[model samples]
Target: MVNVYVLVTSVSPLTSFLHDISVVMTIQHPRGQPVKLRDFLLQHLDPAASHQALRQVKQVISKVLQAAAASTNKKLRTISRCVLCFQLLTFTLLFSSSVTPVVVQVDTQLNVSGLSNDAFDQQITKDLILEDTLHFLLPPLSHLSSHTHLSSEREGSQYGGCTGTLGISLSEDEFLLLLHFQLLMKTSSAFQPLYPSVSSSSSLPRSLSDLPDLLTQIEGFYKLKTNRSCRTDEPPRQQPALSSSQDEGLCVDPHLRQIYTDPPLILTPPFHPLVKEYRTEVTFDTMTVRIRPEPVSSACRIHLDEHRGPRMANYPVGLGNSKISILVMDGSHPEPVIMSIYTVHVYRESRPSLPMFGYHVMCSFVQDCSLLVQPGRPCGLQPHSGSQSQRNACSSGHVSGRWVVPCLSCSDNRTCDWREVSWQPDGCYHPIVDHPLLQDCMKDRKLLFIGDSTNRGMMYFLMERVNSTLEDWGKAHDTLVYRNLNRGRTLVSYSYYPQFWLEKKQRPTFRQALQQLLNRSQPLVNSNQTVLVVGGVQWLNTNHLRTVSEVLDSESLSNILVVVKSLGMGFHLPVDGIRSLSLTEIQDLYRENDDIVTTAKHHGYEVIDTFSITMGRYKEFLQGRCACHFHEVTQLYLSANEALPVVRAAGLTADVLLCFLRWRSFGPQNLPVTERPPQTRTEQRELYIHSAANQPCQTRSRTRGLNPQPIVLEDQ
Candidate 1:
């Protein structure tokens, strides 16, 4: 009777005592013909290279027919006729219902692919993979091997009350001798301590300090026995399991949108007796994910970034939803531990050209982080080109525009007003230029300011617009200098780099401080009133713009005017007093800040482009102390609307207040400017926010209200 049809589909009633094993196997077929045990085990078994040893010999014949159906002498013993080898096999079952039905023979003439042509060259000397031999046909039900702790009314009436059928009838050569006795009960390490609760719950502990808490308590005991719920005949009642650090980890790549994970090597079972059986172990080298924030019905104005590469996390077009985690740890263990954890979950979707302004500013001189044209404008409507393939093609031209607030300023009754909302960068009408036409276009300009503290907040915003105040400025990184002697002594200086073009021994590098400020002839004055800005957010390279193209082809430093800033947007929140910054070092600081803004615009310099106006204003930074700076009421209305300079009450800083109205686009048009076009002309261009009494501020409320508090950095 060799018609072996054991069709077990979705079988799990904890293998309902594998329907009392009525053994009857006999097979000889080397042409005795009549074969059809699924067409002779599909012409000699190879379910893509051995279906994990035919599913562990159907789990050792369902634990030897559940030990003879939990025997009271239900009997079945004597299973020892072995010599199998697809790569070493042996067998035995020793059952007991008085040992009579033992007819188990299998001969099908040695090899027609029934393995042993050196089993695929010993499965490539056991490096094995078809997902490492289907990891023993899906083992991780928290490493399954239950020791009959069956109550909850007998495993909920044996997994939802009875569903029958187990008629055993083996033949395709005794199903290849029951897959070589399930690969000798999965590679017998002396039949694994004769099942001491599956050798202590599938053993591993050679102490890597309790292997991540025993692989998180065998993954929360196989997720509490597969989240139990078997209520068909209603006996369901056992819950309590959880703790392995409450176990929420492992969710990996749910259709990825930059939620990475890579330090993984957790293997063990190719016949695991711990250590060399399918071995694997990188333990961990470095992985760190944190994220956190998720309470949203709107207000967390999202902005994540975490990257270490292979896209670990970014989420910028804001709205909300977060939860990162990842961790991993091991640091070659001198006390580093944390072995594994993973959870990802992010979500964004808001868009209509997302800006709802929290804050954004990078303008060291708006030098094209793409699209801002206007200077002899003809690269065919500037399809954004500082070249290197159109520099991020208009990188969201600084949040396209909108955020207004306008008339509202009380003191004692509380509307104190942080210059009440005002960013306008979509198109470009930006008129308002007060403070004596930017202190008469910095009269005889020198403006140096080296790097960090966002280029000394554009030299304390053009020394509070040409000396209306900051006579000294001091946050101590040194070099200071502010001049303005009633506005034309105009000087400015600022040095403080705090290590930008990093070489650092006692400091020097930015090509040795631009060769000591071009061998100082007292403040780089070749004339055409010296304008040397230099930029920040610290790291910059094309060898610092080839030392600002050898100080702009020096004929004794050719009448100065250098610029190059470009790198804004850095909030990176994982919250707890803010200052974070890791989307893998903000993608290696935007590929070397867009390759040093395309080699500082092929060596000519002058490029503020506050990274497309603070790259969608990184959820409006300024949460206090320095969540990457911006609010002195959005840097006094981005320096009174990009350099027309008027608004006053100052405090937080870095959007380079449009690099002081981009130093009136490199000085001397004799101020009073006008522009005016955007009403519906679209290709994008309308940055207008007026009112320091220059009037025009009325688009109220697209929602704003953040108050986290801590920004006092003052010294500019």
Candidate 2:
């Protein structure tokens, strides 16, 4: 009766009124008779409900009250079943206006003998899927590469890498489930932003001027709260040490069980299972305090007052009883179907501002793991010794697999086994571009690389590979060209972009670099033999992508191959005063990357995402260089006591070149299975050429001064 009264009077303030009413209806009356629904409404229904609640709900329920008022003069409105039915009808109408039914389909391919759709929907929610995927065990980090704890049976599994956690292997069903939810997760507003900016209205309290006695009190509370140390067992290799207070018999005081009070600090079990513990160690009179995550959870978002970021384990902590909110994707069953948000009280003794020298040390050596530790194979392509021409022997354009280094005991660690492994794409094989293959691939072709230093690096590798006599390579933002006058007669050019690479006083107008590319006179003029790869979208804006799409849409360039290189992961190192990209910055980059990929595909251009190739090997970024640059891998044929031509380019550069080769050799028909778009420029052009040949004869000039070649489809 109280619940019913509360629902009608506080309709505007009560967000969960429907849920409360449902509970009230299920309660049995003290008397052994059914509760009189008509009498109940007459006693509890308030006029304020009609004035305050949803207009549609108010109108529907008001009609029932008017009908009851018409019959109020009757002496005994006794046991009429119709009155009870009408009361339920009023609720149904109110609920119908507020709630819309959603139809759930598990999977088109999921065939089960007796599983019902409702049961499937209930069992596998969006939150459930996310929690499961985040919980999937990851391969150990690079420092733990030599740790031999992995079982012998799991030795054949594919994920292996150093330094970072980026790749993972999933079964087909798991992959489908993860992919389905990921698409939905991106559109979901249920999950809060990992690092949201603090609002002006809810400003945090001023930082403690000096180290408070609260640090000692908090530590003492933890020590006294438990009988023994919670952490006793050694954690898995490369994983942080985690332990639960419940395991140590810490009593749960009902008074302190406040997940709804100010600050919402609930320091007890029903604690987030994904993150078992958060431990803080103070040293050197609080001059260097570190907070660590004790579990293998990678998706934890840490918030300390105004400062916020994801995966902020081992970061510096300052003085005071700081309110720390750690959000992780873990099943807090029988609770809300959302990512678990836990608030813990951490006390540290230090200044809030981190010094640059200390920041560098923490980021370089002490920071055990990053916020986002993607589970999969390590960065770069794995080495393969098999014949290169076998179909099904190479990998997709985005290569996978692990590097196998043989000489671990050499005195010079740098020279220790630079090249025991050979480059191989993961699934199907295309011949490696040797001197002869290079000539055949680029014979009379024009290759243009447009973007930043990364693309320039690839051009340098190809140039050196094309001409062994070349001695030096230049690093500048200029229009430079190389022509192979002897063997293939190929022309390779590099064009820097975004106009910011130029001096401020001489910068061109917006997108002038791309505009010039399209407006320039063509020397080769043969669209069929031209290939252009545009990269460095990390610095590009949406306007740049739109301009690029226009170039791809030009009918004169339709037949040429154009590839858009996706953004790669940046490291903690700084380049030209620019530090590594923050997680928030990376999110923005991803949006731009998606726009570029969509724009590229809309105009039949190929896209190659190098994020996976560089994400896991971020630690390999040489000091004093751009955080985006990676170290080069030396090519050594140890079996034959011979060395291959030393490709001075990095692993990313080599893999990108291999991507083009794979696309050219297979021609899209034999592409390796991956989640990216299946169609390439090669396939689109082939279809166009095939269709054009069947049509009526027509004269179409390809360029200014060349014989118009008839549309022809020939077997390569």
Candidate 3:
């Protein structure tokens, strides 16, 4: 087989599908080994060599080839996935037979890292009219053994659910995305018929089609299984499965905080086709789990047995205990999950269970009298320590004398003396002037926050400090990013609940989200310099938090700086609000958070101790003002007897963040001691809520209600 080196150079992008990219190629092959294009390309497509242009080109080519072959090579099967990311990056149709094998031995070095969005996309259409050209890019559908089905049409409408979208223009960008998405999912299986069939006779299908119903069917199956109490193999009591159309889609609101717990139990000893696995088979007994919330608490029974395994140790779950899940940490893993169990095991019912990698956790209920603490594998503890580094607020030259700043708003100017406060010099300092060093450090970087509103606040807070001039603040929808195009190309952005589930389709799995994030970021950003924060502001319940953390505990988690903050801000419970968690419930929530933090840290994530800071400030900022959205913080009053802007809140936090950015870097360094509590502890005592006993445990609730909705949290 001959090997060829081709350089792709740019053409009119809006005109053509890809700009040609150049790379000096050196193809090294064991002599006489069959050199398929897929093998040849995989062996040579180096990011270092091609400025990452070869990435998309490689995916399209590889998927087309890999799907064509029925071989389930473990390497290939394990090649997980991401959202359908199709950018007209670079490259075009591939025909292995088309390549005239010739090798030109040459060595040259050029960096293409700056070349953004240069790669091959089979279905990325620039013009709606040019959809036909995209068809040429993909291998013909004849390559795949099966074709994907499009959802049936609604009366007089091309599109269906999220019904308003029907008759939407095909030329719209969303339509293109919807189309590409359909193609990606259809193709997602293995590499066969990645795309639906289209005719040479017509340019566009006479009728519009959306994602195949099969995708929703899978989601429906999982939804029906979430939170089910115990079941061993033999599909949980025959529930009616819905067709794709009837299934509730994955596109729940980004702000929608939901937790689905499906403790799926599988039997090791194979069961006969007709044999029924019963609750009694494993020496299991049932009992109720009583949570404080009157209605969120269900009469769900737990199944426990005393059988011990080589790795798993049984713990007796005391009745009516606050804890909701069993976190089984196998000692063999360095910082990885042995397995986990949640409410699903006790529910014996199902509803869209939280999306998790079922394969990662082997869950079965075992009865023990008390929780067992495994050595070196404590169930609920942050494993890491804080950095010794500290930058004092008193040290900064920007602060020379006593500065009085405005705090939260005051009504009727009551209690004048109580309103005036002195700036505390004990913590980190935010320098209003002379941050050139800090600017240079963060320059040319893309900082993104993807959780709920607190993360949105985080993005807003960071933007206030780094860039002097803000471009497009709060204007963009779906993704909110601060653009500093001229300086460092430093883009700071926030995505409110970053679209886990598309509008009507099923929510994407974690791997898919990771892929989309990676695709968006500049290729060079990795664990050393960036942090991917999850779980700070949404889905505080055990099931949801576990789901989010489980997703965070991914292969991508290792390569990137992963920071898992507990859900909700501890301080935000409205002092007199109609809805609020009792002190006990809050403590319980924090305890749940600690368990998640331990699991996350063991799986390689830096846990931020927000719970400590929020608890301490609960009497201050949280009760200080009943603000729901940390939309923008303003110092309402300068000081007693002085009318001015409230700069204290921002001033204090700015300094704290300043210390974080300067000394407590996200890459490899632990948080600075000043930012981290002296010690990290996970306890339910409200008095020590602010104790930093655990450097990595922080749970600041950010859910909408001051507490959970009093409404019965039964299966919808």
Q: Which candidate number would show the highest lDDT if scored against the true structure?
A: 2
Give the Cα error of residue 715 in candidate 3, in Å: 27
lDDT of each: 0.36, 0.37, 0.32
Q: Write the per-residue lDDT of candidate 1 for residues 206-262, one digit (tens) a residue.
A: 432322232333433433443453322211121111111111222211111111122
* TM-score for each predicted model, relative to the true structure: 0.27, 0.36, 0.31
**Candidate 2 C-alpha lDDT tens digits along 1-716:** 11111011111111011111111122344212212222233344454442233223333333443344446525344632121011111133212222221212222121221222333222322223233223222212432233333421243143222221324444433323323222222221111111011111144324412111212222233333322343422111111112112311121110111122111223444444444344332321232222222222322222322233333322222222334454443222333222344555444332122212111110101111342433232222222233222334333343443222222222222322232222223444323344555566667777777887666666665665566433445555767666652254877777776456468878864356655654442564536577777786266445665666566566356577776677765533322223456666655665566676667677666666565455544444321124454422133333456443333333554444644654575455554353122155443222222221101111111121322211111000
Q: Write the per-residue lDDT of candidate 3 for residues 1-716, one digit (tens) a residue.
A: 22211211111001112111222223342222212223344455553433232333434433433343334333455554222223332222323332322222222212222222322111111221123223323535653334323321231144332445544333233333344433433321111121221211134344334332322332233423431433332111211111111112221111101121112223323322122221211111222221110100111111212113221112221111112232222323344332322221221121112222121111111111122211222221111222213533232212212222121222211211221222222233322222465576576555655665455555554554455433334422245544553375566555445353366366554445444554465454545466555554435434544554455445344465555555444323332222445555655665666776667666655554444334322322211112222233332222456331111121223333444445434321333343332322232111122212111112111221222211110000
Backbone clash tally (model 1): 34
- Lowest summed lDDT over 10 consecutive residues: which window, candidate 3? 7-16
Task: List residue ranges in candidate 2 displaced over 4 A.
Answer: 1-396, 399-426, 485-488, 499-506, 518-521, 541-543, 552-555, 574-576, 587-595, 631-647, 662-716
Best first by lDDT, ranked = 2, 1, 3
